[model samples]
Target: MKIKLFFLLFVSIFSNAQVVINEIDPDTPSTDVKEFIELHSNIPNFSLNGYVVVLFNAGSTSPYSGTASYYAIDLDGYTTDANGNFLIGNSQVSPTPALDLPETTLQNGPDAIALYLANGSDFPIGTLATSTNLVHAIAYSNTSTTQPTALMNALNLTVCINENATSNAANHSIQRKADGTFEVKVPTPGMNNDGSGIVFNYLTTTFNNTSYTEGQNVIITFTTSSNVTSPVTFTISLNNGNFNASDYSGNTIITIPAGTNTASTTITLVDDSLDEGDEEFILYISGLPVEVVASNNSILRRVEDNDYQISNFGTPLAPTYGNVTPTIPTGYYASLEGLSGSALKQAIQDIIANPAVVHLHSYADIWDIIRTADQNPANHSKVWCMYIEQPMSKIDQQQGSSIVGKWNREHIFCQSRGGFQVALGDTADGISIWNTTSAANVVDGISDAHHIRVENGQENSSRNNKNYGTVNSSTVYAGPTGTQGSWKGDVARSLFYMAVRFNGLNVVNGDPSEYNGSVPSGNIGDLATLLAWNAQDPRDDFEMNRNNYIYTWQQNRNPFIDYPLLANYVFGPQYGQPWFASLANSILNTDEIKIFPNPASEYIFISGIETPTRILIYTLSGQKVLQQELSTDGKISLNLPAGIYFVNMKSEEKTETKKIIVK
Candidate 1:
């Protein structure tokens, strides 16, 4: 009690920053890199603007009451951390010192450290110490019997004893004790004087298993080191991207009572109809008592959905798209077998050049074709419009002047570029190649249903006749989700079809000037971009379905839609490779067909098949084992050895294949 005169004389009773020099470590084992001084404020996040730390040197030869200051730090514009502590130390000291000191910066002598609420200019490097406006001051030494220093009287700070007599100076630091006296103890820089940095220092959380299911309950255990005298509580927070409060039911707060060191809480999950397949969340701990925090901040958890199931369509092409059998006769491509390169392209052009195979209504009859072909798969009452790629009502045809939701026929191969039925271009769909073949060059009259698509009236005008390519002035479509990417492939395949069925109108990749054909006698280009688009984006089901519907109209199908890689064999990189029907993954679109009791010994029942075509069973090695017409009840009898086999169900419109195991 008698050695505490310095704090009583200097500490202000009504000061705003209430900061105290908490701990000081002057000497380490080697260099002074670990030396540090810790400051603590009673008010958290307190601003230490008008404060300065001045180190006074006792080496002054004069016998005066004051000592000359060796170093001073201006505490302007610095605020204490959330823990109300401002730490300063040499470079090696951590958790990152607020004021970094050079190695061996602090002198290990009968030096004094002073905290003052004054301007930094008041304490020059050699200025003597003063008691004016001093906040807290402490005098420390590395030796027990230290030389006399003016800090004893100038700041009324009595020299505190060092640990050189017992623990040695390097292993100990002088820290302020609870009774307001300094003692040589284990060095604690940023922690409390009593050596506590955490309130519940031994608290931990554990879970038996991390996986759960919807409608199931999870219990998390919270355990501490020793029994509490009263109730201890903590809060559990969630950090899943889609965590809704209503999706979970729990108290969210766990509590442990006196005489017990462990507690737990239950979290009940509410099912979301299993639409979300698998859900994951991280639990965070917070809201503990004052000065207390959880040792483990977060815990990861995953829940499986019980009702999640999917019915796949066609032969899924991995991440996107699926192959659907083209609506063509069995021997449709029999003439083009074993062909490659330009020869294969010429054969395809020959097969589709006959205009008699295609059925087209006049350009005036395009509305009926679009209404039937572009019907939305989700809402049949609406028709899908190109260009803008939006869904418009079937009745919203572009009439006299009401053009809000109206759509018009978009000639993908523009009218001036080999796409009109007359020289002057009447709206009668196009000048029919009728009996004339695609090889015959018609200068100004050509129109077919394959090149015409539905588009919004305004968007049709917005895009006028600009050739499709990587042009900076291109419209970006956002309607109907994923339309932008799919529309590119759609337009690319349509243009490829036009280049074949209408050979007079060339599609080139050269200079844009060569394609200004007001009479349809010249090129219509940027074919390089169109070919790249064909290779980049595969044909999706929307295009496949549209191709099949158009086949019903013209009796001719777009071979590119059936064989996605055909464009490559003809106009792309693989120009000379022999093409095969097997390369085309065009197989099944039976989304309704179902085969149950798949791993069967003798028989299996099938359902949802439209027209009973035939059933075939094959081994994994591609050897066919059984073939028979499908019964009306959708039943097939099979007896095979214990192995994996594929059951291929053929229907009038599509085919379905499911892998099964023989019991």
Candidate 2:
């Protein structure tokens, strides 16, 4: 927003004008050169009544180079030509008959003259130049006893005047009434100097004179004045149930009061039940001793008066998995040739069912088979699976496009494949596949796999796509040239992609282009989702916990299934036993941690957690309040008024979080 301040009153008779010069060559002067300058003043009807002074100053040099010179031009009796150009007088020596130059010492070389107009209060139109009508100064340096180099320049001038006559007018003030109405002096035009200098004029229209309601009354008022007593008749116009403008016919005419020279009027409201938002009202007063108008409007709204409530989703259930116990089913992949069907099935099942199954590896056939099993009624909803696939050129060509290739790979061995789809209890609702196409693909794939079920399909051939001979020349053989090398590489790559996508954990470090076979970390849940059991076992694996619990129940004949509020006790706040506290302490002690307002009343400030660190603040009730990085000085201010809160801070090197109380 830009704002400008203007002075309304002044006693000085000097005229105010601004001039600008353009187009000047310091090296040479041209005869066709043009120059312009403008002049602005408050004199109502000004004419050329004096001379203009022009000064020239030369460019500066090493020590003290330039000098100043002045020239005076008689413009008092000058007349503008057809092109609005006028030559005052022919150039001569130091002084002319009608103009004179002040005595001043010259420094070094020729200096350009700065021009000033004397007695500019009476400058006539078409006589002095303006922004549109410019004046040109042409000059040339004299190398000999002859002519000097003609310097060409343009000058532009602007004139401003303060014709405000209300500077001495009687002060007119307005006050809003307690009843949400306005009381004004009737015939409001007698408040200023004939309203001549007033830019806007206002008058009241239809006076609603209505009373105000309890919750709906907002009013605004304005005042104006006149200096005469001709009985200014003012009419007010009512619009949108509000005062618009006042006029004799269509304008508000302020008539002088009967006995006094000043007149005043009161505008009141009868109805105030207007809706909240922006409401406008115009007050136009005319026919005042002088012409003037004033306007005022307002916006209204209802204040909110309510409290906030928190909705509860109830406590979570205890994890079904138990201690690191393995549960492998028999004859799971018996159909596959040369493969230990039971062992492979058990391994795959254990990989999928283990609460610590942070990562898994398999061929397309294995994935298809597992997906089919997951679709079975007995296994449905019991297993959640996600498959990450590599982007290959052969697959791209087979699917006609990379996007289509990815879609096919995701649904590979899906439940949709006839008998395999049905036998494995495969359904459209059960499988989710993440395909690595681009870096952004990982982000999107992670979002999609976060919540999806797994279904097994029996037909591995359809899912594998062995017909590579027709797609690419490099792959003349079925699948790949190498029997096990290519398959193993592809499986490892797929597993790496899955682990990274699922847990945001990057375990492998090597160039994919180099194809270096490197084994990744085998800590399953290192990047896997955690699951707890028994509320005290201190283990985090759903499948292991479930298998162990089942085995214990079967061997000991112990009915400990519903052991002392197991549901609440197992999933409650005390379940993990200060896991977050340990993590927090480790981070703070290792990273020069500092927290301000230790016993804060409203907020806790944190600093020095190192770069690229993630900070999370949660309430005692497990409600997250802050989650972001601690860049720069590593400072984080947690807003939690007067209460105990937990702070979880994590980085690539370590993860630590702690609890602090606010006042």
Query: Best-fitting candidate, measured by TM-score?
Result: 1
Off by over 4 Å in 1: 1-324, 401-404, 422-446, 473-483, 514-518, 586-663
* Candidate 2, 555-661: lDDT as tens digits: 11011121211111112222233222122122234236566665566555677655677777765445666787776454455455676565666676354444456
Q: Candidate 1: worst 10 consecutive residues by lDDT?
A: 310-319
Please write out the lDDT profile of model 1 over residues 200-306, one tens digit for every residue.
Answer: 33456777676787888878888776776778887887557766676688888888887788988888888767455456667777766643434344455776655
TM-score of 2: 0.21
- Give Cα-based local distance difference scores for all models: 0.66, 0.29
RMSD of each: 24.7, 30.0
True-vs-predicted CA distance for residue 261, candidate 2, Å: 4.9
